[model samples]
Target chain A: MRRSALTSTLTFYLPLWAFLVLLLFPFYWMLVTAVRPNKELYNLSLNQLWTSHPTLQHFQKLLFATHFAPWLQNTMLIALGATVLALSCAVFAAYAVQRLRFRGSGVIGVAIFLSYLVPPVILFIPLARIINELGLWDRPAALILTYPTFLIPFATWLLMGYFKSIPVELEDCARIDGATRVQVLRHILLPLALPGILSALIFSFTLSWNEYLYALVFLSSTGSKTIPVGLATELITGDVFQWGPLMAGALLGSVPVALIYSFFVEHYVAGLTGALKE
Target chain B: MPSVQVTTAARVVRPAGLVGRVLENHHALGVMMVTPALLILAIFLAYPFGLGVWLSFTNATIGQAGRFVGLGNFRYLLGDSVFRVVVLNTTLYAAAAVVCKLVLGFLLALLVNREFRGKRIVRAIMLLPWIVPTSLSALVFYWIYDPTFSIITWALRRIGLLHGFINYLGDPNLARASLIAANIWRGIPFFAIGLLAGLQTVSPTLYEAAAIDGAGPWQKFWFVTWPVLLPLTVVVTVFSTIMTVGDFQLIWIITHGGPANATHLFGTLAYQRAIQGGFIGEGAAISAFVLPVLVGAVMVSFHYLRRE
Candidate 1:
């Protein structure tokens, strides 16, 4: 049945359009400010949203003048390092919990989930001291090591659901066919659980990619700073906010994760809904 | 009699030595599998949590250790008006942010639950705010709130709506409100996504059944939809509160507790005191205060999470 025009507009179209505008405006403004010529950006007399003289100078400056490239590298290395570490641990732990079904496994699973509830804000203060003690202070390793404190619990939780979805009968058949336990998991379970693994990787990567608090607390030196910390710190020199390149960095910083996300959008959303769906 | 004899024979044999059995046991394998995750969580998460508690009671500095001051940090925080303001701002920020996010999120969730054209694309687009890094989006907000060059201020001035540029971030109350608006903007999508998942599980059949009963739209929603959304809403709100209370990014980028410390949340305050201010003990104490609230919230929400 078709919805009437008046009811449709009032109920769906109006709110939908309004929500769209609210959400998209900031990103649109980010782009406008990024490309707008400095004169136009600063001058109030010029059109507020429209930029007649847009330039690539900010992007140029961001690449050549700043340590943005290293910041990107630093962010990439840190995110990847953390994602890999977390995913491996999660895979094994999830496999054990779901497949092995050993005594106390249920308790450990709940314990790990409980750890996920612990926020980074509380731990960062003490973690800073630990990083200092381990001599990982001011390095990417500090972030890599610390990110798992959140990522593993999350990834493990998601993977536990994934592993459980696979039938135990398949593993039983594999074993009956003389496949070793390791071989069965490798040939059957891992392939079957590929989607889950992809979701976990995407999530772990994004978690570390978008992380700010730990990066801010641990990495102080400019050269070692990740994108979030770098953008906030290095861009604003004293009181003058560098609008153009700051937006440039902001836009560019989001690209890697956004790219990864759109590529695996289906899996990401599915895994999320699946995990939270009760 | 034969079954009892078989059981007795199996019990007597026991499959061999205790050492060999333990080696091949499922529990041992389970422990081995969970070792890596357990190790990381223990070293990084568990250790630091306990350490934070210990550090809070000491008079520790950045590099120097001090003897136990025993409630000195808490007593000092009680006396410091800045800390008092921090607590007030944190509570206000969280409560306001939570209410806004839930309301807007609920509206958006209901909206998106209805079938429409290009709904998939619309839903994906709705997620953008939550997807991008807050540091980046908060910068976008920072630029918008700039005292002289604010686009919002300029637009109002141009429309003859105001005599001068509005100081969105410069005013204390305005700064706090602006930060909350920015926060709500980011948070709404997460609430929407999670609640939408909840909405999907209600099954159209439930709605159809209500419609057949001649229930009005409002009645249908209140009777059917609201009850189904309750547990999920609780789960999401609890999760959101934990994250929001612990939040540091949006505040740090937008205001940094600026305009006379109007917008400092607990996380930002803790970072300021411990990391930036180098008062490790005090910062630790500030951060620790939220623990009881977080644990309480988590315990309450645990039922909702484990409901299935």
Candidate 2:
């Protein structure tokens, strides 16, 4: 019995640490590469794991030489804009689908899920054409307009799962207390569904911030680029790969969404599992 | 917040005016409530989806208008060696990555499901890769795979495991392997966190009952845990398959479907043909070909939705 317990504990702890180390190694590499000075970065003799003296030169170059600021601003604007739009649409759509029980509500629910199924790879071609026709090509507004297509479906579905869990009976007493449908929704349901709303917000925000394909297709100008497209396409030039500024850009770009995620991770996980559960 | 005149809103519910008549029917209000979402879906999503299918039937190019030539683009794709390689590569990429994620994720979930201090923090760390933008993270992967400065090569050489550079993304086989490794890294969190949630739902009493039946830990897992986790496993499978199959940015950044197109996925190949190569029709056809599989996933998810 002692031997069995010992072996099991070893098996569990050993692999768990391995998983953590392997998973975190890349981000560690990103930070190390980002801040490592040029002299040490090229020195094959120096210890590769840690740099003796780190420099902010890469971030300096990234901020001044490149369109990094514009890209960051663009990403933030698009993500927030898309999140708000998707949430409003999702809030009403989820309420209607989960609560209204009107004719064809079931059909609409199915259609929304089907829309969520459509991937950017499939839509980008036609969307590019549409963007051109609208003369929104090479504009950040193009991304703002298109991102909600994917976001709203996901947010709506997630919110639907959330609203479904809040018992219909919770609103029964509130409605009898002279609370209107809108009142009951605002007072009784919305508060209960706030976690769902926040989760949807986080999901949509991260998704839009992380979006690559639509932003890549719609916005091409350096001044208008989002972080993902800018870092992926423009950061590298010729065979002289700029590893320093590149990693700096990557590390910086990831910080906003990561910060938001750390704050609401509990609700985020519930919303995520709830999303897949449906 | 919007105007909150529920007192006046009640009058509208009873049809005191023309607008009241519209508000009186809950069905009308439901449609009204969903209009913004419906409109967005109709114009941007549903129309574009249909347009993509139509474009696939035509010989569309970047600078020129195309006429409908039904099945012509697909006919070309059927014989195209590059497209065939793309099909093979995509299937291999998704399959390899999905299998690695499933196995590793199941193990990780099992290990993490145990009561441990700072468990929340550990799970948060696991979610890091998924949280980071794929393009940015994939750039980090690109550097890790860089020929001269590759860190993996450095570490392996340090351990006396390798004498020379590993050529992580420089050769076809190695490049495909490298891309799959990155995909697995990003995909693990989705499966781990997802299945861990499933693991928590299984009652302790069930395990206790299995224990009392003289079932060992292995037997307990096989009999009690497996059956309970099966439905969740199915859901996770469908979700992962669809996302992995259609993934583009990860491939584009890491390998760009390079090393003689050994790492080309359907999504990346479609982008190359349509956008980069300017053969929009063929690209649409390449992309549309994968629709049936995605539709299958959607049907499965929809079945779940309906059941819910």
Candidate 3:
């Protein structure tokens, strides 16, 4: 029994610990490097694992001395705008495809799923020209408008799965009672599918917030940049990497999504696996 | 009484006209409901996609829309040595990263599937790598792989494992390995969680039955667990493969296809040629080159999904 216990520790516990460290060490490093003093950060003699004195100086500089605030604002505005736009469209579309049972609904569902497979890399090049032609170059409206290309497909697909899970009888009964289609959706279907809607909303928000390539391609000016693009481009001038403030920006940039994930991780996972399962 | 009845009838008839009839029609309502999404997709996705294909046939630059030169851009790319390297690198990167992620992630799923203390917390913490913006995490990696002051180098030297600093991103081979490593790091969480969900669906009774048939752990897993997980595995693998192949942000941030253009995937190459270099036609061709592979993957998934 003792030998078996020892073997289990070696085989399972040790490896699990190692995987956790390997997976999470970067985040811990981000936190440590963000707070460590610049002198100690560069000092080879000092302990690099942890800081003797932690400071908020880097956060202050990241917020005050750079375009980080505007970037944050821009990311927030764009993410929220895209989420709202995508969710409203997805809710109605998902309801229609999953519940309305119109002709060609199955084909529409499959097409939407296939559209999710279309990666942004393939589309970004032509999208650049289109954005320019539309006079939305370097504008948040450009992303606000374009993000739905990816977002709506995914949101619609996911919400379709959710709508499938809700019983059709509820809506049928409500319709029999003289509920208009909109009234049925508003009262019966929407209430039961609240979890799914929340999942779609959170997923859309995070996906838009985390979107890098389009943001990188579409927005050029400093004032218009999102957090990812801004931190990547503006923080490092030439070869001199600002490790401190950059890490600070990364930490700050990740916090909102992290907070949202912590709260709604179950929904998030449901959204991810739910679509796949269906 | 006749006037009042006529007014009520008028009120009823007004709503039952064209607008109400349209609203009551399921087909019309479905079309109406799907229009906004379809409109957005048509303008942004479908239109641009077609335009992208058209652009590849031309020699269009950023400002000037050049006349169509059929097959010229593709012919030029086929001859280019750098383009060839990009094709090799992208394939290798996706294949290596997906294989590693699946193996490690399956083991992780197995480990986490067991009853352990603080399991919920561990699972949540495991997802952080995937949940965070990949660009930001890649920046952390960029810092970790710094030439002079890398923590990895410092730790290795202190432990007497090395004498000189290893330039993680300087050498061509090392840079490719580094990028793949970072990709695997970010991607493992997705696979682990996905496979964990699959693992949960397996019944403990099946394992017990396998054991009753005189099976060992490996046999039990092979006979019982593997079958259940296979479908989910195929699905997640296809999804990850597509994402990995089209991956741009991580490589772009880390190396920008540097060290003699060793790390340029199709996405980065397209960006370099089309956006940065302003050879819109060439870039479009480069980006569109991967369409066949993506379509093939989608077809396979569709087939599998249909069978399921």
Candidate 4:
């Protein structure tokens, strides 16, 4: 009996352990390649797990010699700015749909989300012309302007779920106590829906940070380009992939959000699940 | 922000008397809250979405705007052989990805559902591909498919699966297959977790009851599990299909719709023409064609997924 139990345990865990190791190895290799001396990278028989001599030269070059720092800064700035804009717009819209009795409100909610699902490829061509007309090409504000089209509907939907989950009596009591509707929202609903709001912020920022097609198409100059486009074009020259610097840039780019996501995994999944529920 | 009286007038929900005025004030506040979103959507989303429909009729270009050529772009697209290929590729990609993701994710959910040690950690890890920024993950795959010094190539070679080095992206047939593989790798996690959440809501006692009735595992799954999961399956599958069918970044970053345009889905092909090849009107028409189909699919799925 013990033998059978032990065999079953081994059978179950071995595959899972192997799968986990395989899944994580590429990320581990990315770290190893980022740190290993350039000479050791070509060594076919080099140990896959660890390197003896690690250096920060690749990271240094990525930061100083390359334009990674400024790109990182721009991504952060644009992502944050876009997040703020998307959230403010989305939250209000969500609240209005959830709380208010208005004409065509449900239709508007459905319409906005359907609009959000319109692919960026379809939208960016005309938007490029519009941005040109507005004299906003190559500007970070372009992202802030274009991002909410996608972010707002989804964020509004997410916040709608959260607002509906809130008890109606809280607002009723606040209204009876002479709080205006705006006051009730500010004092009661917004504070209560903070988790939903945070999830929206994270999603909006992440979406902005990761957006490539518009950032590539709208922004013309290298200085103005976001990290994804900049790194893809500038970091690797013709016939040279620049593994060390590219991996370093990728690692730097992903660390903040990955950490943020780990911290807010529950809320993040809740937001997605909430949004996914019709 | 606007004329206070005008905005308030817009907000009068049931203008009966004094209470109506107060409710109008609340309605005005709601309008104010919703304005920023409405403004952004109007200019950026609604205007552009409307313009694409308009441009589908005109011969639009990036720099030199062309004269109105009614149905010219759409008519041209219908004849274009590559456009047909793109439509087929997109349909195949979405169908294959959705079907496989459903099957594989369902299996994984079932496996993980069984009470296991370190199940929490496994669940967390499973969500990584979905949570990680797609561009970052795509870059990782880019290197994994690197012509030289690829660990995947090394593994394949070690297993004697292929005798020589495989330039997966450079070969036409292999390139499409490879792009699909990369998409499935990223997509399965979201489907798995979403369906797993749905599965966790299922009562275990139902399974026990099935067991007592002498139902085998496969029979129990078909009768008990499949029906309960159908609605969620439709929702998750349709959502992923819409996103995948219009996927731009992964293909663009990896292959640039390369090796003689073997990997051109509707999104990438639209991008290629609009941005790279500079046939903006034709590109807009292609995407406009896709939009209605997507909307129809979403509406159908959403209608079914919503509980009666």
Specify the highest-lDDT model's number. Answer: 3
Worst 10 residues of 3 chain B by lDDT: B5-14
Q: Scored by Cα lDDT, where does model 1 land?
A: 0.89
TM-scores of all models? 0.95, 0.95, 0.96, 0.91
Best by TM-score: 3
Candidate 1 share of real interface contacts = 0.76
Which candidate order results from sorting by TM-score in descending order?
A: 3, 2, 1, 4
Candidate 3's C-alpha runs over 4 A off are B1-15
Candidate 1 Cα misplacement greater than 4 A, ranges = A1-3, B1-24
| Pairs of colliding residues, candidate 2 | none
Candidate order by decreasing lDDT: 3, 1, 2, 4
Per-residue lDDT for A258 in model 3?
98
The better candidate by lDDT, 3 or 4, is 3
lDDT of 4 by residue, B180-241 (tens): 87787778777877788778777989989999999997999898888888888887887787
lDDT per residue as tens, model 2, A1-278? 99988987689777889999999999999999999998888777788889979999999999999999998888999999888888898899999999998899999998998788788889999888998998999977788889999999999999999899999888887755655566777888899999999999999999999999898888878889999999878878878769999999999999888899999988888889888776
lDDT of 2 at B161: 97
**Highest-DockQ candidate:** 3
How far is A219's C-alpha from truth in model 2 (Å)? Answer: 0.6
Q: What is the lDDT of residue A189 in candidate 1?
A: 95
- Ten residues in a row with the worst lDDT in model 3 chain A? A172-181
DockQ of 1: 0.58
RMSD after Cα superposition, model 4: 6.5
